[model samples]
Target: MTTAAMPATPADPGAAEAADVTGRLDALDDMLRLGGGRLDPRLLDEAGALLDRAGERLRLSGEHTVVTLAGGTGSGKSTLFNAICGLELSPTGLRRPMTSKAHACVWGLDGAGPLLDWLDVDKRHRYARASALDTARSDTSLQGLVLLDLPDHDSIRAEHRAEADRFVTIADLLVWVVDPQKYADAALHRDYIVPFARYAGVTLIVLNQVDRLQPEEVDDCVADLRRLLQAEGLADPRIVTASAASPDGVLGFREVLVDTVAARRARAQRITTDLDRLAERFAGQSGADEPPAGVPAPARAALVEELTDAAGAPAVAEAMESAYELRAADFVGWPVASLADRLRSDPLRRMRLGELREELRNAFTGPVGAQQGDVDNALAAVAETVTGTLPPPWARAVRAAARRHAGELPEDLGEALKDALPTFNQVPRWWWLIKTWQYFLVLATALCVLWIGLLVAYGVFGAGGDGANGLIGDAGLIPYVAVLAVCTLGMGYLTNLACRNMVALQSANHGERMERHMLDSIERVAEAKVLKPIADELAVYAQFRKDAAALRG
Candidate 1:
C-alpha cells in the first residue's frame, strides 16, 4: 500500500510575524550601536523608544488588537463607541467637551487584564463584552479586541489631548470619527492625518453623524474627504459614513473590526509600520554603501616611511655604517695610526645608540616633537584614502579611528627602530685575520728599521778597526738593509689599502641591511596601530548598513 505524506503543516503566521519583529528589533539595535556617535542623537532616541514600545507591546497578548476611537468635540465618537459595543459603554452628551479619561471595552477578556493595565485605563472605566450572562455569543467575531474610547482630540484641556495622543500612537487600529460639519477642520487634518500618513493602512476615516446630511450630500462630503486625504499622501484611505443614532449605526465599523480582529495582524502591522518609518529616517542619514577595502598599499607604505623618518632610522643606519668603518680602521690600521683611530669617537656611540632604548625614549620625547606634523599628515592621508567614498558621518568615524591612538605612534615607531638596529659587538673572522696580518707586518717593519740603524752606527764608529773589517764585509749590505726596510713599509701600506677596501664594502652592506630592517619594523607598527583601526571602522559601517537595510525592509 502506497501512503501519501501529509501536506506540510502551514507555517503559523503569528510565529513568523513575531520572529520578523524580533529580527527587525535586533537590526535596529545593531544600527544604534554602530551609529551612536555618528548619527543624529534625537533620531536615535526615537528609535530607542520605538524599540521599548514594541517590546512592551509584544510582551502583552499578541492575540488581542487595540482599536481607538479618536475625534474632535461633537463628532459623536462616544456614541459610535457605545453602538459598536452594543451597550452604553462610554458617556455621550451635548456638552462642548467629553470624557478626559479613556474607557476600554474588551471582548474575550481572558489574558487581557494585563493589556488593559498597560493601557492605564481606570478599572472603573473598563467593561467586558463576553460575559457568562451572554448565551447568544453575539460578539464572537469581535473576540480578542480591546476597544478604547479616547478623549476628544481637540479637547480644551492639554492633558486630555496629550492622553489621547499617547493612546493613538500605541493603538493597533485607529478609527478616526468625524462628523460632516467638522470633517474638514484644519486641526484634524494637520495634527492627526497629515502626520500619520504612513499609518494609513491601519487607519479608518469614519464620517459619523452623517444622518444630518442628504444621501447625495453624504456622497459629496465623503468624496471631498477622500480627495483631501489623497492630497495629504494617504493612499486609498478607507472611509465609512454612519449615524450613531440609527439602529444599525456602527454595523459597517463592526464589520471592519471583525475582519481586522480575525486577521490578527493589526498589532504586528502597527509596530512594523512604525519601524518602517524610523528606518527610512535613519536611511536618510546614511549614504551609499562602500565596501571596506582596507588601507591601500601605497598609503601603508607612505605611513611607514613617514614614521621611519620620524624615528631617525636613516640617521641611525648611517651611523651604524660609519661605526663599522671606524672599528675596521682601529683593527687594521698601522700601529701608530690605530692609536690615532682610537682617539676618534665611534659614530654610533656619539649618537648614544649604544643605550638604544633609553636614548630613543628621550629622542621621541624631545627631538621627535619636530616630526609630529609629518606624523599627523601621514595619518590624515591614510584616513582620506580609506574614507574617500564614505558618507560624511562614516568618514568622520574612520578619520577619528585613525587618530584615536596617535599619541602612541611616535613611541611605537621608536621601539620598532630600536629592535631593528643591529648590535655591532660581533666581529667578523675576516676582520681578525686581517688585523693579525697587519700585526705581523708591523713587527717585521720594526726589526728591519733596527737592523739598518745598527749597521749605520758600526760604519761610523769603527771604519778601520777589527769591528770595521768585520763590518766591512757588510758595508755593501747596508743598502740592501735599507731597501728591505722600505719594502716592508710598502707591504704594510698595501695591507692598509686592502683593509680600507674591505671596510668600505662591508659598511655599505651594513647600511642597506639596517635600512631594510627599519622599513620592515615600521610596516609592522603601521599595520597594528593605524591600518587596523581604520579597517575596523569601515567594517563597523558596513555591518551597520546591512542591519539598517534589514530594518528598512
Candidate 2:
C-alpha cells in the first residue's frame, strides 16, 4: 500500500488510491498458488511484467482524443488531414496512401513507436519542432494526446482494411470522416460503425464535402446518417456536418482534442486503467502480492529430489566399499606380506581417511556421492578440469548434506560406501583385470610361504628317532639346525613385517593427503562453481520483475 502526505481523513482521495493499490497487491497472492514447469513458473513471471508495461502504455494512449480523418478516395479527407496537422505534427499515414491526398495526423510525445506499432503503422508522425513548441506554448497537457489521418476506410485493398483494424486497437477516440454523397452509404454503416457499436460514446461522425450539398440536402444527408448510426448501436454518436474544402467543423474537432480528452485527469485515469490490466497479467504469473523469496515450497522439493536421483547415489557407495576394502588389506596384510602392503599402498586407499571418500565415490560412481566426504574429496581434482560445470540445486543441497555427515566416514566407512551410490561400484574394465591379478598374487605368495615353511620343518625333524637314512640328513645335528633355522625364520618374519608395514603406512599417508586435496576441490566447486552463479541469476530475475512492476505502476 502506498502512503502519501495527504491522509488521515477517510474520504481523502489519496487514501482511497492507497487502498486500491493494496487491493491489487493482495490479489497477486492468489495467482502464484498455481505452479508447474518453468514455462508456467519462470516464463509466466516475465510475461506478467511485460503485460504490466503494455497496460500502462494503454492508459497513456487513452488521454489522447484520436480524431481520425477517414473517407473514400477524393473525399477531401487528405486536405482535412493536412488542416488537422497544420496545428499538429507531420502527416505520415498519407505518405503513400491510395487517396493521393492527405489522410491522418498523429500528435503525442516523442516515444510514440509502441503506440504506432500497436496500430500496425510502419510509419508515424513526430514533431520536428516539439522543443520549440514547448518554449512557444507553456501548455504540457497534450503529452499523451494523438491525432490520426487514416487511409480510406472503404479502400478496396485488404491492406487498407487492416489499417482500420489496427487503429481501433489503440485509439481511444474515433472520428469517422465521410463525404456528403457517401455519408449515409450502407458500406460505411455496415462495414465500420456496426462493428464498433459497443464503443459509441467515443465515436464521432463527420460529413465532408458539405460545400457541394445544398442547405436542405445537407440536413437530410446528416439525418439519414444519424438514423443509420443509431441502428448500428451508436445511439448518440455525434454528427458534425463538416467541410474540409471549406472551414466548417475543423475547429470543433480541434477544440475537443485540447479540452476534453487531452485534459490531465483523463490522461491519468487512462494510464491507471492500463496499469490495472498489466498488473492483472503479472499477478497471474508471479504471486499477486510478493513472489516467494525462492521457488515455491513444492517446486523446491521436486527439483531437489529430481537432482538427487540424477546424481547416482548407489554408484558412489559401491566405489567407496571397494576402495575401503583394498585400503584396509594393505594396512593389515603384513602377515601375508603383500596382502596388507598392496591394499594400503594404493593411492585410492588413503583418500577415504581424509576427504577423498566423496571424490573417489564421485569418480568411481557419479555425482551421487558428492555429499559423501570420500566422494567429495575424490572429485576435487576432476572438478578442476570442468571449471564451469554447474551442479543442479539438489546437488548443492546433497553436497552440503554430505559435509554435515562426513563424520560417519570413519565409523561406518564400509557401509557408507556401500549405501552411498550405485554408480561408483561399477569398476572400469581395466580394474577388473587388476582385481584378478590381486587374487593371483595373494595365492602365489601363500603357496611359496607354505612350501618354504614345510622344507625347513622337514629339515629340523628329518633326524628321525632311528637316526638312519633321515630325510634332513642327521639326528645329532637336528638341534643345531633347528636353532639356526629359528634364527633365519625369525629374521624373515621381522623383514616381512617391516617391509609391509612401513611401505603401507607411507602409501596410506600420501593417499590421505591426496584425498584431502580432492575434498577441497569439490567443496570449492559446490560453492564457487555452481551455487554462486545460479543464485546471482535468480536474483537478477527477481529484481527485473520488481522494476518492471514499478515502472508500470
lDDT tens digits by residue: candidate 1, 194-290: 9999899899999998889888898999999999999998899999888877877667877788788867888888988999899888876566856
Q: Candidate 2 lDDT, tens digit per residue, 207-233?
A: 776879789988888888888788778
Global Cα lDDT for candidate 2? 0.48
Q: TM-score for all predictions?
A: 0.89, 0.40
Q: Which regions of candidate 2 deviate over 4 angstroms?
A: 1-67, 73-98, 103-150, 157-174, 178-203, 207-290, 295-315, 318-322, 333-552
Model 2: per-residue Cα lDDT at residue 13: 27
Candidate 1 error regions (>4 Å): 1-13, 131-140, 338-370, 458-477
Q: What's the number of clashes in each of the models?
A: 0, 51
Score each candidate by Cα lDDT: 0.82, 0.48
Q: Candidate 1, residue 202: CA error in Å?
A: 1.1
For residue 187, what is the lDDT in candidate 2?
A: 72
Residue pairs with backbone atoms closer than 3 Å in model 1 (clashes): none
Of candidate 2, the 10-residue stretch with the lowest lDDT total is: 30-39
